[model samples]
Target: MTQSTPSAQRRSNLKHRAILDAAAQAVAQQGYAAVTIEGVAALAGVGKQTIYRWWSSKAALLVEVYSDLVSRQALTPRSNGSLEQRLTGLLSALFRLYRSSSAGAILTGLIGEASRDEQVRAVLAEGLVVGRADIVTALVQAADASLNAQAVNEVVIAVVWQRLVLQPDSLDEAFAQHLAALALAAGRLS
Candidate 1:
């Protein structure tokens, strides 16, 4: 069962979401090379110390922005259906969320920065684990029909993530629906 977020935690999450929005916009407009914690603070209308107090580095802020943006969008379903249909809708929703320029730009900047900063990469991976796990859990629920399924299911999702994030390809709704079908089938969740 999902636990409810405490009020204090919810309030803190709201503040951080605002910061992420501001930071994402700053990075999207100025480029990662130009982004600074001070600039993010200024754009966010918060003190520089506030940003520094919460995050260790610009890369860390970016990672949090990406993670927060992904996490805010709940992945649960409103109706029951075949796994293929459910996963198709979920992937399509993910595509729609990531298609936002602000969020996409933040993720792109982090990925680019990670190539040059091993420390940033490790930190980002650690920070993103929970959000990634949440996403994986949604996929797991949809692919739970078959025995010996999880390994194949993860591979399918790995491919979908690569196609959507790494490759120079669009993640249109049609593509998401198609990938979801393949992934669910590959997981033997027909």
Candidate 2:
């Protein structure tokens, strides 16, 4: 493999971050229906070919955008808290994130698009479901070694997704606490 010069690498990294940010902004402002590769290219001040050179499709770009956004912006659960507290902290962070950031719109768009697009659905299944589930599963195992990780993860995902998609209005600290308590109780039983 050819090595990239430090300057060239920096430039490429800047461009990549710009494209992801632009894609996120496009989705947030225009909704997923209107987020075209062309639109993202224009917003990022890059050529359409530049985007295509890096990502195979808009769905692929969106997956990267979601991952980058979550890594950079999503809140981390406290390491010191009780299992209930840690889970509550994590869910609350997610709720606050979805409520306050472009991530919310992007998530809604992904979910909506998944209904009709197999590519988007696959991306969601891998990125959102598995990614979020892994985090919760680890937290559940930490909380109670006897608890069923997969089952608890499913419950956590279900509760969060319901708040995100079905009842966004109810995504609050109280809801986060309730969801955490419910998950902990059910997890301990199983």
Candidate 3:
């Protein structure tokens, strides 16, 4: 069997990253509905087949886009600080990521699509929501071994969802700190 050469692999990786980055930019600027395979291909300077070879549909492409963004941006628990401090940091980072950039627009677009598409919802929930929840759960447990990780995760996600979907204007550093305090208090009660 023949293997892909190192140069070939590098080129492939570059192309893949280019497409994802272009898609993100497109979504950020024009929104999901405005993005297309041909548009992304043109933006990435590739053939339409290149995108189709990797993704079956625009929604699938968007799932990958959000997945990549989430993997890069999601914060984890830090052992160097108290749980409240670390949690607050995580929340603040999330708020900033979602507030100040195209990441929020990408997420909002994907979320709106997820409402009508089961596959999109699954991918978004697994790759974005559950992944972040897992990180928060660990932080909650680290903060207090006796805390209910599941409940804490639920509360954390609820607050984030409220800010992301229901009330985007509510996200801020102060809110993050307050949310962390509430989570900590809830953990103690549980």
Candidate 4:
């Protein structure tokens, strides 16, 4: 009946991250459906109750893992490039993030599984919307033309993520740059 102390909490947090990483690796290799709480606990060398105590479901566990895995690098626009070039660089960074093997597969699977889980959908919506809005806000603040900012952001994010999640083969950095250039041109005209 002893209470856990602050150091024990920190250790528990570290164990939680290890569990999440192990879960991500398992999901990357075995796909989402095959990764159970027990499997992740076994992978992380922790107790199943430890996992359940922190995360209610595998989707919750994977979402944090996916976010951390994909977002370790900052996705800021380049300072030395033209608006189009900066946008292209941004797109390329995003392209690489989502297209990275573990993050990409886990994201796709999570989105699919999120269809059945409202909590996962909410988390996805919050993360994605904040990210997209942040990009658009940065563009506007960086003087990426005032008109049609929303449209421009939509086209860039859509093209990048569509290619990342759906058209993995036909899409490349070239295509993303081309799309960004077109969106920027159109935004300037508007």
Q: Considering every candidate listed, which one attains the maximal TM-score?
A: 2
Better of 1 and 3 by TM-score: 3
- lDDT for each residue of candidate 3 in 1-190, tens digit (9 for 90 to 100): 9999999999999999999999988988887778889999999999999999998877778778866876788565567788889989988887887766667777777788888988878877876777556788877776678888777777887777767877888888999999988877777777
lDDT of 1 at 102: 59
Candidate 4, 26-133: lDDT as tens digits: 987898778888998998999999988877777777777776775675777787867778877877776676556577777677677667888878776666645446
Tens-digit lDDT track of model 2 for 60-161: 788778777777765667898788888888888877777666777777778878889998898888878876567888877766788888877788877776
For each candidate, give its TM-score against the true structure. 0.75, 0.91, 0.87, 0.79
Which stretches of candidate 2 lie above 4 Å from their native place? Answer: none
Q: How close is candidate 1 to the true structure, as a TM-score?
A: 0.75
Q: How much is 52 displaced in model 2, in angstroms?
A: 2.2
Candidate 4 residues lying further than 4 Å off, grouped into runs, are 1-6, 185-190
Better of 2 and 3 by TM-score: 2
**Could you tell me the lDDT of residue 95 within candidate 1?**
73
lDDT per residue, candidate 1, 1-190, as tens digits? 9766798679667667667888878867887678898888888777888788789888888888776666677655435676667767877776777776555666666666777889877876677644465554555565474533454456555665566457635777888778766765666643
Which residue pairs show collisions in model 1? none
Where model 3 places Cα greater than 4 Å from the true spot, the runs are 188-190
Candidate 3 or 4, higher lDDT?
3
Please give the lDDT score for candidate 4. Answer: 0.74
Which clashing pairs does model 3 show? none
